[model samples]
Target: MFQETVQVLERLLRSPSQIAKHCAADEDPRALFLASLCATLLGAAAFGGVLATSRGGLQLLYSATKVPLALVITLVLVVPALHGLAASLGQPLRLSAVVSLVLAATGRAALVLLALSPVVWLALDRGIGYHSSVLLAAACYALAGLSALGLLWHGVGKSLRGAFVIACFGLVLVPTGAQTAWLLRPFIGRPAQARVPFLRHRESSFADAMYLSALSSQGIYRAPEPNSHPAPRGATNLADDAEEAP
Candidate 1:
């Protein structure tokens, strides 16, 4: 089992074409799905826990659980859209095949995230400010997303229509994934937070939070709204709602 898992991870990073063919043929799909699912859950959980190291305590557990949950939910929501998009673009794939392909791509991304976990943890440990930490995490996510896109591109086919389909899928994916993660925010709790909450009340959209984070990272914070609650000492002063992970 360990050897097989290692082989799958290696193929995910180094031989996406072969993995794509396996998914397209639906060969031993149950085994493929199980392996990819395990990779996704474990990798995402590890990275999430690392992200929470900035704000230790129950946050490690909360972030670890929520990150995998977010990924699973995002996959559930987007797989059908990917199937439909591929079909519409004349790259029709069996729904099961599509599912396996997507799971593999996401698992690949999770592995990338896991690889980045230590770097992010080190940055947080070095006392990077909250806004900079958020930006750093976002950068790591973008890098992982790119890794996933490579596998997905191969799975769909390296042709023109496949490129179009993947592009369309990405458009749907970015916002959906972002909103899902945003809805389950506080992955990196404020360092000065009195108590860690499993979730935060939805204030702004993911796009808004990211935009604000970018500005805050540059030391240009948004003014607080009238009658808005004050932010915690170590939180970004973005309308009293600190931007969380992307």
Candidate 2:
């Protein structure tokens, strides 16, 4: 199993275009699906290890869950949209193929994330600060996503009614992913906190989180003070620290 997995990984990483092309040619979509799924899960695990540094082992487990949840959320939202578009455009609309292609694309993104893990580890270890780390992680994810889109286009554009639908799906996918990740917050540990929580309060919108991160990074925003007492488990507290010199 290990050897076969290695071979699959090598092929996908070395020739993602070829693997994508083969998958598009109907060479066992399930194989591609499994390969991509494993790749994504493994990549997420590596990221989880990095998060373990500041967030603790419990949060590391939570971090591992992010990509899978994000993947499911994005696919659930984007797949139907793509299917409907394909149907309306009189495209063949092979649902399985589309799904496999998407998986491959995202898996490639995960591979990129794996490659980026070292850099992220360095940033986290060297103390790049909360907002900068968030921005960096977001930028890496965005780059990976764009690369994935390009791979998807290369793999399946020949069959689609142009690649316009792929772009359209991206419009929905990006926000869906961000919101989902927001809902599953604290992937990276907060400065003043220790224990991780599940299903915390939704005090702010996703836009607010990103904006505050940016503002706080620039020293323009003053986050309210944390209570002297310990925060309860499952409580959400994302307020930035005013004392830390950014």
Candidate 3:
């Protein structure tokens, strides 16, 4: 099993074209899903470990749930929406092919995250601020995700009109994942309240929160001035909603 897992991962990383071709050739979708699951779990575990470094052990536990939740939520919305869109356009696709494509993309993302674990750990250990660290980690994930999406487009073929579908899918998946992450707060640090709340009332929209954070000097939002820098590296400002970002 271990050997097979290693070989699958190697193919994913080293020769994605081969995997795509294999899938195109009608490889078993279950095997692809299983391999993707293993890859994603390993990546999530690495991320959880990094979270454990700064956040408490409890955070490590919470972090474990994030990826699976995000994946499930995004898929639930994306799969149906995409199928509907494809159908409306008179281009119905195989569910199995779509499933295999998404899993392949996710598996690639997981591997990418696993590779980034070390850098994240180092940045956290070096005392990067909570907000900065989280954003950086997210950026890493975003890059990985975009790469995976690119692979999806390439592997699935342009004739499938994958680019359009992926764009629509991304529009739904990204924000849903973000909001879901927001709901499952404090994965990166201690909560402001003494007790952890499962679902806090959303005071502001995600866009507003982002806008406000950008307007402020604290969050990812930055002004046009080149001289203006973000919060000091490694600054801990837990007073700000630590739960804002994933």
Best by lDDT: 1
Top candidate on TM-score is: 1
Which residue pairs overlap in candidate 3's backbone? 127-234, 128-234, 129-234, 214-221
Q: What lDDT is reached at residue 120 by model 2?
A: 84
lDDT score for candidate 3 against the true structure = 0.63
List TM-score per model, in order: 0.92, 0.82, 0.78
Worst 10 residues of 2 by lDDT: 237-246
lDDT of 3 by residue, 132-191 (tens): 665676677687778677766655555657677667667776787677666665556643
Q: What's the C-alpha lDDT at position 113 in model 2?
A: 80
Arrange candidates, best lDDT first.
Answer: 1, 2, 3
lDDT per residue (tens digit) for residues 103-211 in model 2: 7777788888888889988888898887787777787778778877776666555445548766776777787778777666667766567556754545455665676
Q: Lowest lDDT 10-mer window, candidate 3?
A: 224-233
Question: Where in model 3 is the C-alpha error above 4 Å?
Answer: 86-91, 159-161, 191-203, 215-239, 242-246
Alpha carbon deviation, residue 112, candidate 2 (Å): 0.8
